[model samples]
Target: MSNGPTKRAADWAETTGFARLDAEAFPDFLPGWVWLVGAGPGAPGLMSLLCYHAMQQCDVVVYDALVNPDILRWVKVGAELEYAGKRGGKPSPTQRDITLRLIELAQAGKRVLRLKGGDPFMFGRGGEECQNLAGAGVPFRIVPGITAGVGGLAYAGMPATHRDTNHSVIFLTGHDASGKMPANVNWPAVAKASPVIVMYMAVKHLGEIAAALIAGGRKADDPVTIVSNASMPHQQVASTTLEQAGAFVAAQEPPTPAIVVVGHASDWRSVLDWYAPALRENPIG
Candidate 1:
């Protein structure tokens, strides 16, 4: 019988009524096929039921750096684990190699799970991988997860959109492949496009980004919230303004893997903050 974390997780699931769900509702993990699954932001509980189902049956799990290690406990025994994460300024496998490996594994008749953090289609290169799989005649399934921008902001008590604040919200990545601000982004237009903007991988170029938005007509005093390691045990939220964001980041040096929100929507955080206290009451190991 399984012991330790896996056993405890199973017990927790059963207690929470997951065990009562119909098993046949989930699709079979067939051999010679691949499943591209999203692991959610950083919290194991945020994972979808389909994602949990895949974890229990895959023959091999190829996961990313952002995937919480706590989630791996649910994997069935004897399954292989492979790390194929890409961290900025670090040596990592090329995207082509990762895609090719998935194809090879499926071709060998192994049930493969290409797991990624957050929604795979949202700036995760999942579309590219799926394109490659389709070209290779490989069958696959896509299971979406809660994206960090929306989910991470909520954990920080900042809503991506407020009925009273914004009618539309924009999502964008801060950096490009060259580790610099994305060159093709229309800063001024983007600034005017929506009332709220959520950025990913933006901490490194926050200063430049803030300057662009300021130049694009956003007020310097506009609210900004930075949530680091969102939904994780070490999560930290820092509030600042567009004018002070650059200095705030440099002075405080909030940890990376953060989500940055710009707009009046962040003001809600002051009133809606809940996760911090919840963590205090029920801490996770």
Candidate 2:
């Protein structure tokens, strides 16, 4: 039951031909409230229905660099779409500016949608935006989407965890706020405990990070795979070892928006791999 001019499920179905859902089942996208939504890896099919439903109701969409362009096609025709993405090594909007823009939009009585790639909460700087919104006394909703570490890996035919390969998985970023190796990571301790390690945005210093993992007791030959542009049609994956990951990447020069997975779970890509089920999409092949 909704507070608006509610449309019957049958009427909605008769118009859109989707019989299972009613428009009123969802919370109304009220003006002056912001919704931070995760667009999920790169595949439009991977996006959550809630994210899609919310996008359809937004008055403005402020999206990130990683968000798949295909998903933008679903935004309501009249909605204003704005790009506020920040890509590494590229000139981009400051985070403060982005957050301030959101506040400004909300104050203007617009239903703003902040669409991010993958789960908004997972290293998406979503928490910061939400904090800013809270301080400004603006109401907002958080819509979780599949993270690339999980969903992107799956699309690349790699699992972050497997009973036989790993009992635990660790996800870490390559760079922190400074755009260098993270200052707080206890490399050895993390390397010792994590059987499957997924590294995000680590391409710039893959060599140094790989060396650290090896020095910390990880096997030099431990299988490591890099997945780039994951879940997208142009996705690429590269396989190397802890000792050679940096060199392999340097020689191959795989593109950015990549993640590095270190551990036995990546070995499964040899057998269970199915980036393109019909196409046999192995980057090495």
Candidate 3:
């Protein structure tokens, strides 16, 4: 019962094949609006067609640090690109400032694309930006892309859900909005409730988090997998146990934008891993 134009367009696309029409055939998108899009984890090929079309049509793109640079290369030449990335313990733009910038661009009669890494709504703070745009009377659309928890795991050859390992999974941020291990998160409760856990932005605090899980009754030998720079050419994955993940990742010094998966599912990486072959064929050195 959604009456929105985007929904209507999607409906038309599904029923009448309007969505299948190539971007080259469509008219330029209207100005004075914003589209918040998820660019997927890091792979350019994983980007949604709608997201790609929006990038081509937008007058401005305000993107995050995690969005793949190769994907941004597709933007129409001469379009403005702004960086509004936020990283843990880094001097990044405030969320309010980024939201207001989107409003300003829309008011300037620009078709704006607020590009984010992974699914914009999933831990990307896209909802707050959308709310700001809505409050300012800016017409907007949300084009969801693959999130890292799912895509990152795939790149590491670990499924988020498996038939024998787990039926229920939990996804949580390693830190709160302030970039610290959330004291509000009852680790004991979560450890008891969820069999599989996927954490974002937790690399810096892995030691504390691992300790908490162990204190909460999770076994010290529980499987842990850290997939860093997921889906990118330089991607790396480190497999260890709850007691050793902190030390293992620290020793390897993997890059940022990583996803951590914990559960029996992490064990599947031993056999399910396929990225090694691909990497061996295309060695960085």
Q: 2 or 3: which has the higher TM-score?
A: 2
| lDDT of candidate 3 over 8-58, digit per residue (tens) | 466566664434564335445689989989999888878887888898889
lDDT of 1 by residue, 42-105 (tens): 8888999899889888999999988888889889899999999998889999899999999999
Off by over 4 Å in 2: 1-19, 22-24, 277-285
Best-to-worst order by TM-score is 1, 2, 3
Q: Hey, what RMSD does candidate 1 come out at? A: 6.4
How many clashing residue pairs, candidate 3?
A: 0
* RMSD of each predicted structure: 6.4, 4.7, 6.1
Ranking 2 against 3 by lDDT, winner: 2
TM agreement with the true structure for every prediction: 0.91, 0.91, 0.87
Name the best candidate (by lDDT).
1
lDDT of 2: 0.87
Candidate 1 regions off by >4 Å?
A: 1-16, 278-285
lDDT of 1: 0.89
Task: Look at candidate 1 and tell me the lDDT of residue 128.
Answer: 97
What are the per-residue Cα lDDT tens digits for candidate 2 across 198-273?
A: 9889998889898888888889998888889888778888888889988898899888898889987777777877
TM-score of 2: 0.91
